[model samples]
Target: MFVDQEGPDPNFSAIAAVADGRATVTVTGEVDMSTADDMLRAAMTDDVAATTLDLRRVTFFDSAAIHAVLQLADFHGPKLTVLPSAQVRRVLEISGLAGQPWLSD
Candidate 1:
């Protein structure tokens, strides 16, 4: 289960979970300069297993973060849940992604 700490200062508070053989990562932050590695690791956790990323609460994103998300499609399929935010939706669309496994229900 991907755990995220509720409330303010969301950037440094989420956790990725790999359990019973699957992975779930809940990302809640402006994934940028300093947090790319953490996001990358969360995206690529536990040996290329199937993973679900709950990016519902992310307030901001950048190209590097998009690069990281796109990277996952290279080695593994992604199940991402997009919130009702247009900006967030644009991140996926602008990154040329938002179909099939990458855009999970």
Candidate 2:
């Protein structure tokens, strides 16, 4: 699926596609207050039964991003999987969310 953000800020983007009963969302650039909604919209479509978030390419992820992920997990249940980068993992660790079942190593 192709998700387009409201504005043209190339610094932040999220793309999603589905295969094998999983909606894989790859987010790039920064996911802050300005871009969190876009990322959420990209990842949490109507068909979010089995979602996998690929946050490996994300350079920056803040509380807003975490909030979005948590919201999606709440809506989608245990099927949410997250592939986080070192930076993303560090942030989740600092925030005490690294132990969450949805976040993967």
Candidate 3:
């Protein structure tokens, strides 16, 4: 089941769901200091076999969001896959996470 949360900003939203032994979190809008925690909470709920973060709709990402991803990876081991937006991809690359096994275009 997927549950959507209307965050404080219309430009930001997060939806969480689980299916086929994987937990999926789709986040939209800017993920920065103001929104990273919420994004983290939405994405890292359970220690499932796999976790997927769909960030294709995200327009912006910062260090706070990157830290959240790292935290999730730490908790879930190598079972986290992130589908990142162009903007996010650039940031990850800058953060030395580009071409990492856990990230997909």
The Cα RMSD of model 2 versus the native structure comes to 5.7
- My TM-score estimates for the predictions, one after another, are 0.69, 0.85, 0.86
lDDT of 2 by residue, 56-77 (tens): 9999888888899889889778
* By TM-score: ranked, best first: 3, 2, 1
- Candidate 1 lDDT over residue span 1-105, tens digit each: 434354334455447888876677777767764565687787676563467766777777777667766676565754443332356677777767766466654
Candidate 3 Cα outliers beyond 4 Å, as residue runs: 1-8
Best by lDDT: 3
The sequence of per-residue lDDT tens digits that candidate 3 reaches over residues 1-105 is 433365445689889999888999999999987788999899876757899999999998988899988887787778989999999999999999997788986
Give candidate 2 misplaced runs (Cα > 4 Å).
1-9
The TM-score, computed over Cα atoms with residue i paired to residue i, of candidate 1 is 0.69
Question: Which residue window of length 10 is worst by lDDT in model 2?
Answer: 1-10
Instruction: Give the clashing pairs for model 2.
Output: none
Which pairs clash in the backbone of model 1?
none
Clashing pairs in 3: none
Candidate 1 lDDT (Cα, 0 to 1): 0.63
Each model's C-alpha lDDT? 0.63, 0.85, 0.87
Q: Give me the candidate number with maximum TM-score.
A: 3
Could you list the CA RMSD of all candidates, in the order they appear? 7.2, 5.7, 6.5
